[model samples]
Target: MSDAMIKVALIGNPNTGKTSLFNHLTGLNQKVGNYPGITVDKKTGICKLSKTQKATILDLPGTYSLNASSADEKITIDTLNDATNEFSPDVAVVVTDVEQLKRNLLVFTQVKDLEIPTLLVINMADRMQSRGISLNIPQLEADLNTKIIVISSKLQTGIDDLKEAIISYTSLSTERCISAGKIENNTITHPELLTSLSAIELKKVQHRETIIRYQFINAALKKSYKIDRSKASDLQAKLDRIFTHKIFGYVIFGVLLLLIFQVIFEWSSVPMEFIDGAFGSLADWTKETLPEGMFTNLLAEGIIAGLGGIVIFIPQIAFLFLFIAILEESGYMSRVVFLMDKIMRRFGLSGKSVVPLISGAACAIPAIMATRNIESWKERLITILVTPFITCSARLPVYAILIALVIPSERVFWIFNWQGITLMALYIIGFAMALLSAYILHKTLKIESKSYFVVEMPKYKVPLFKNVAFTVIEKTKTFVFEAGKIILAISIILWVLASVGVNEKFDNADAIITESVSKNGFNEIQEVSLNNKVIRFKQSLADEASEAGKTITAQEINSAIAEKTPEFRQAVIDDEISALRLENSALGTIGKAIEPAIKPLGYDWKIGIALVSSFAAREVFIGTLATIYSVGSEGDDEEANTIKAKMESEVHASSGKKVFTFASGISLLLFYAFAMQCMSTLAIVKRETNGWKWPMVQLFGMTAIAYVAGLIAYQLLK
Candidate 1:
């Protein structure tokens, strides 16, 4: 009944459906965090084995064997070797693919030799019939000296059987398929012993050991397993030929990309608009209902505004991850990795770089970590340095708002949305820049390294809806909660700075505005606007009076207009007071101080403030604008108070030109595309590289690049 007594670890090779089983077990009751003292992701979840019993399931990183060749493998090796490790499993579930049982068993035997209780789970059992593969579960359990559970994650079958096996895992044999002594110094059981072995020497020993294990596996499988090669279908083969073809493959990928962008824009639009309007109304209601106070103002103008900015883009983020999960689950991502090798070689990268580059579309932190799979250090480093140039979900909020504001929402060729095309173009530009940078770094970095690229071509299948749903939920939740914390803190601080001021100008803003208004009276335009409103009001009143068959004098109309004039005029005066106060507040001073630096990029002081705050997070740029605009404005028409509406209405104080113009919007997009604006990303880079040197260079180099690109874009477009 105790939690400590029921730790179950899922272990397997890549593409073995290990994660699918984990998702089935965990559902939404899961948490993601970093492993202690390392940046590697650790996923843990709890599954109920029975009405009164539950077990903790830890999904370890996928690795081929106990050979610890990569960082991911080393973690597995270290955990299994140390009995005292908290994450070390009481029951190790070795998941294997039915189609590749031989290769998957390589790690199973290694784990079995460690004297740990083990269960062999043969996944994708649903495919066994189609592939003409049959296994005698009882006989295989007897031969391999472990309990076997045949489960199809796709069909959601055999899950209860697997759970029953886990509850009885203590009875399973820990007998090794081959003697541990076959491995030199028994390093498979005692990983610390591997510290003395050279990389080449260690690999040779692992190779010899693997050959021995396979011999034992072949003899056992000969008795319990049967297959008919002719029964297998060639549908996958046919599809792979086209998908991996050199010429047409790239074309298909391009078309798929355009389609994805179009869907992201078109499908998410209705939900996004609804969310924007909801948040705007919530902010308005908070101000109107809550008793007036500084806290009330902060709640409405800061936290809610900041949150609304990022939350409105959830639909787009979810759709993006939905497509990515589908691609990965359908096994097409592997083909992509294989397909990119030809071009990768020419650019001084390995085919393995493609995974990180594509994964960077979701986030750079994970993409950088994915570089560990690359054998060569030089290629890995180049991939890490350039992966940030690939546009991530963090930049999606900035891009979406700016594009909607500046780019027309018209269709191209009566099908493609202009905004969608622009978005796709930006994505392509990011990828092209990443590849170009990789090529340049390839020529510049002189580190000597050589490694051959090898990629697995997985059998394509229909993506599981459960897997796709979990991925979208997990990824979107992480984006909101993680980015929300930083935005919240910055928003509160920005609210304080924008509300209070250090100088007399901010303090005397109300008096200054009142004195000026009183002295000059209404300006020509203000007088005309007031006169037109009075005229409209008079006409409406006269019409209503006439409809009632009552005579209304011209004097009564003048009296009514005079009665409403002061109320309307005061509203105008209050708006000017709010604006003047914000312009002289602490936030405004900071913005002005940095204005000259960003002015060349077609940015004003307000945008300078957003840019500076967004260094904490790139997505915070929109949130920053939201908070600033919320703080600067008073009395909003509920229908037109969304963040986009506010941004669209923004104009330069000096030139009176629109702030989010076509030139400035393009300039900003180019800046975000090239800028390494995320402090967390910089920190991660520092941790990954084991020093600040590379991240520092990354920071300055990217900023310089972004500035130059923005400057050029603005100058040419304007």
Candidate 2:
């Protein structure tokens, strides 16, 4: 066993720097996956202890007790209790904050009772020095019958010592640290009476353990931990007095939210532009280098560009998560939950729902999973159902591209980018919709489940750098993999649909277009006029080919046409050759079928096709439009502005008017803002609800709302 790879589980109460220790031990070598039968993330990494003996470190979901109540807590308990889980640790490391040592020990003691080899980590040792605090490490270690590693995850201090402790894991003991014998005996005898205890009574039991642990903690504090109470800053209390004020708290929160969105929009543009440029160059390189054909088109246009739309938003998502992690690490998020509980309760949501709502800004899948903390079934369900309404990172690509297309980039209020404001407004609208939907759900749902909100607002502490970095990286990775798979599959399917046309409908389109143009007196004009028309038609075909790529080919086009006109082989061949000349060449046939329906929305066939194809995911819409426009243009510039110009300048066949009017652009923006078009979201809702009913309702409801809203915008603006 000593020579074998040891499994170590790092567990602790929330906000206790457990993740910081895990990151310091494992660095970037980590993998995140879902716990079996649940969406709660399970994070594991490999820690190299020696040449032959390695340790597989598991960062278990943070919990206050081994008594499993929430889904997250259940994972922690089950993994430790069941050896068959394979995740069960040979040694358990309990990370306890030096400041909150007493409260943290409750979990530590519970782990010891499991009789696993254990080591106690007293993190934030740097803070003890700053505040003139000291610790008798040997005495504390002796008292706990375990090894103690006092370290600062922030400064990378005591990390070597901690690693050394891990190597000497066999020397650690699993004996009971403190005397809980009498308390356990008393509780067991009066089990029935304890079972009937109130919420406050349950808390008293928690406090009793805290007090018992405090005795030893205080003794250790006198010997080694020291703090000058008079000199310590009261900034946290001062800030809390204002930030957590009954009336002003909500106001401050609102203001803070506005600022966050403003910053996210303003700060993320540079990195986004760089990523956009990099991917565009990569696409061009692939197209030129890969020998022009079907596979080249698929690689360059379908896969690369499609994936770029998602990857470009990584910076923004990382930043958003960075702020969230810092807030949680500093214990500010818990205070926010405490402050919002009353307001959330009135809306039939728990304070815990705030975390999910905030997290949903980055993505909804995890947000739905985050609802496991909500005690009441009704509240949890409502939270899950409405969370998708929060504009997620997947929506960012759509919003960024659309805002660039529709909204003017002039400054407003001498501070905000008009485009940024529009993006922020869309986010706000999503949140508003979520709340309204939750309110309606509260009334409609008849499930009776007792609701409770009890949160411990730990004292503010400086967040550890290691923890913040680990959180950002881990969350970003999850975002990429989860959303990436869906986007890839959808991109392939969409390319096929746009590239291949069925029957004589597409086969004879070129002849029909040519005859119509000739009847309009184009045949009476000079050869230059005829050639110009042919070139324009060819350019349109090239655009479609470029947009659709190799997903559809001339062979598939001929096969589809053959099925329609087996007897008229020569006519079919001529029509097929002509149509293939226009369609296979580029953006020729995209809007032919749906033009009439979309004409009322002020969009031509190209815009119509872009609108429909984008329904799979919002971000893909931008890439789809880019591909369509790029197919028609002569030079290679995949800039959004270039695409917008091509769209605006193109004349409509029905009216001879410019295709992209101000009203049309605005209508498109509004439609995307309101539409529940993301297939990934629909699939997730189905998975979360475990049925088709809710997702179907959501899809239809959102689409209907989008149609009404879009129609109104177009009519009024026009």
Per-model RMSD to reference = 13.2, 15.8
lDDT of 2 by residue, 1-718 (tens): 3777788999999988889889988989899998878999989999887677678899999988765557887787777767688798988899998877766877777677666789889888777644434567786777677888888998988888877788788777766666557354223223343457676776567556554544554444455444443244456545666667788887887766666766776788788878877777787778778897777777766677667767877887888788878888988877788787777777878777888998887777778877765656788888887887888777776666667656788987877777877877788788777778888889998989766543444678999999999999998898787667766875565555545655555556667655665576332222332333334444544577789773556665556445533333332233334434335433455466677787777877767766777776666666565555433123223442233344444555445565666688777777776678677778877887789998888888777767777788889988
Q: What overall lDDT goes with each candidate model? A: 0.86, 0.70
Q: Write the per-residue lDDT of candidate 1 for residues 1-718, one digit (tens) a residue.
A: 3434488999999999999999999899899998888899999999988776789999999999887777888889878878899898889999999888878988998889988899999999998877667899889998889989999999999999999888887788777777756656666876765788887777777766776676677667777777653464567755776887789888988888899999999999999999999999999899889999998999999999999989999999999999999999999988888888898888899787999999999999999988876767899889999999999999999999999999999888877988999999999888888888899999999999875653446778999999899999999999999999999999999999999887898889889989988999866545543454466567768778989999998888778778888866875577667777888999988998999999998999989999999999999999999999888465424544799877876667555567899999999999999999998888888888999999998889889989999999999999
TM-score of each model, in listed order = 0.69, 0.58
Identify the runs in model 2 with alpha carbons over 4 angstroms from their true place: 1-233, 281-290, 503-616, 631-633, 636-653, 656-662, 687-690
Cα displacement (angstroms), candidate 2, residue 590, comes to 8.4
Best by lDDT: 1
Best by TM-score: 1
